[model samples]
Target: MMKRPFGIAVAQLGPIQPSDSRASAVARLVEMMREAASLGARMVVFPELALTTFFPRYWMSDEDAIERYFEKSMPSAQTQILFDTSKNLGIGFYLGYAELTTDGHRFNTSILVDQTGKIVGRYRKIHLPGHADHKVGKPFQHLEKKYFEVGNEGFHVWQTMDARIGMCLCNDRRWTETWRVLALQGADIVAVGYNTPSVNIHWPEPPHLRMHSHLISLQAAAYQNTTWIAAAGKAGLEDGCHLFAGSVIVSPAGEILAQTQSEDDEVIYCKADLALADTFRQHIFNYGAHRRPEHYRLITERTGVGDPLGKEPDPS
Candidate 1:
């Protein structure tokens, strides 16, 4: 069987200011969708927390104020325009947002909508980064651990028209298990979105180094998993935080196929031959023949949870 090429667009957003209304943000996303369609892309991917500013950075004492940041309904009237636009253009998309389920649970979630604009799959971020409570000494706050619950559902992959796809959010990309789990389920392409501040509040490093770290992580994951990776970022400075713009599409061979040039709202596309994954997946990366899960029970037994202060693992 011959495999077809899938054109993917990675949309890097600058930032959604706290003052920007949801409608205005959707309008911007709509424009990007049109741009990607014009570029011959069949799917477009946006960064995590795309609809609003990265609210996790700020700690709100008022519960109502915190809830205000979450969307009660996924395709709320404000976001319906995005679905309508995608349907009109016949392009599918992966979008990340703050989800407030009717059951009263809040999650950092992302959804996969087919070309018809019908949502086919949904994923909640599992590895919630940052501290649960506000730290007084940190220059700024990273309270995602406080705002969103740890996702309960496990990693999942969806069978789409073009390829087998998977979704993961910001910090999840840093964990090797995130990609491995998806690969084990036969994912050919994984789309990840991130809203990362340039400064590591827990421990500060050079801004350029932080950006380099982002690319390295993406490339390594692509090669290790033998899958295509489309990673989008919320770039530019948001409020007082500076985010690195390195949104890129990586091939199964770990080559960067396309990337955004600016730290702003930009759309870049690449036509990936989905079959390319077979070159590696059936060879050096063949999990069925190479993986020995029974011997890896230690990984499952040890959750690897650590204290926020970076405590060394007990060498017991």
Candidate 2:
């Protein structure tokens, strides 16, 4: 069979300080987009909350956060340059930002822009991590649950750039069900953006395990679902808190084809053979051939671990 190759890039961004203006951040993104185009990439993926500092780290009023960090419109005055450049370079991009709706709903969102600079798809983050209450003694807060509402739109894939593309943001990538839903929809490539802290605020987790879990999640997802994955991260120190950088592009065969070497603004590209997934999709990972959905009802029926299904209750 002939190879169906696609060129993709992951643009890893450095920290955006709390005082940094949106204009400055967009300029950095435009620079990386140009570099990715020059390197022969058809599309690029940027990290979560790329427009501002990771504000969820601080506890603030919802109204204040929305006014300071959320975007009312995608191509507003500050972000128009990204679309213009995309159209000029004929390169598509995936960007993550805070989206405030006209109806007053806020979401941690990511949009998929085509070569024409038009947004073809959008994904709101569903699996919001962290607590709504302020952790009094912790160095930083993870207030995603408090600031943003749960995503309403379900996982979806779009046909563009001659391939099926799906998107998920931050913590969503850690869930297997997220990958399975997209793969079931025939997704060829999955784009993920994240802003993860280097330290665990809830427990004394070894810092190294953060990077390890990030990489392993993508590798396992790619191989199991037989889809290409491009993950971008906002790394390095921001306001004294550090985020690890291991942005990577994983092939369907569970291999890291490319990875960012620096914890700064970097672009890593790979020309992947899209057809390579067919070998596994048609055999080992073939959902239609082997999946037993009937027996997996517990996944959606309950939120936490419980007694074994069909097991008899112990006599009192």
Candidate 3:
């Protein structure tokens, strides 16, 4: 008998502001979830910082604002409704948020909740960007570094819906190590979500088609790792900045299965096969089987000050 193809959805959310209520956000998710189910998706993935507009820049001096935006727990009363909705629909999801710990360790977090409404696994973002201090010329895109600490939990993978799933937040996909670690863990699909803006004057990448910012990073990661990737985005103009929107899903064979259009909330849908990952794994490109770790001793070496063989010591 031939194996069946699994399915996934890229839920590209539009600009959700500080003014957007939790009920409204949950409603949007409900609609999207139904839409995905209609498209035959077994699973769906939302963008990083999905609950609200990316808030790292505000320097949120008012503690109340911080608590209001940060999710203290998964399925908080407002979010539990989403879990219930997914359970009813029998479609699992991967969600990202600004998580506030009980012990006060805030992090950029992502979690996998099954169709049965069970939390399967969680991951905190290891790569944190933006400055903690307010920049005079740059306006308010400041302070993720000062607010939420870097994620302590390393990269991870989960088994869900007959597929080996993996999760990563914004900025994590920029580093190959993110995909490599999960690939080594035997990942079949990698879920990534972001809320990238149009202008930053900082590390602005060019678009492969219409815009330089989106698509490139996602396609690169999906193709290089030989794993399916579903990338969702919070896009469009929010508080004067235009967030780029190009949510997409790619197959292990480097084919773009689906992609969302610009500046609006949309769902890009496609069927993902759990077994296609074996095509890459069985080939010489398999990282676990063919990785040259012995030659990789050079990455950690300080090129100028230290030698790979540790022949020289730093002058500092």
RMSD of each: 3.0, 3.5, 3.6
lDDT tens digits, residues 119-147, model 2? Answer: 99999999999989988989999999999
Compose the digit string of candidate 1's lDDT tens values, residues 1-316. 3776899999999888889988888888999999999999889999999999988888786375456689899799999989999899999999999988898888999999989898989999999988877788787888888889988888999998568999999999989999999988888899999999999887668889988888888899999998899999998878878888899999989899998999989999998888889878887898888888999776666655643333546644
Number of the predicted model whose lDDT against the real structure is largest: 2
TM-score, every prediction: 0.94, 0.96, 0.90
> Which lDDT values do the candidates have, in the order given?
0.88, 0.94, 0.80
List where candidate 1 sits over 4 angstroms from the true fold. Answer: 305-316
Candidate 2 vs candidate 3, lDDT winner: 2
Q: Give the 10-residue window scoring lowest on summed lDDT in candidate 1.
A: 306-315
**Model 2 ranges off by over 4 Å:** 307-316
Candidate 2 local lDDT, residue 84: 99
What are the per-residue Cα lDDT tens digits for candidate 3 across 207-290?
Answer: 333344356666777777778899898888777766788788988777778888766779888877766777767774677667
- Model 1 local distance difference test score: 0.88
How many residue pairs clash in each candidate at the backbone level? 0, 0, 5
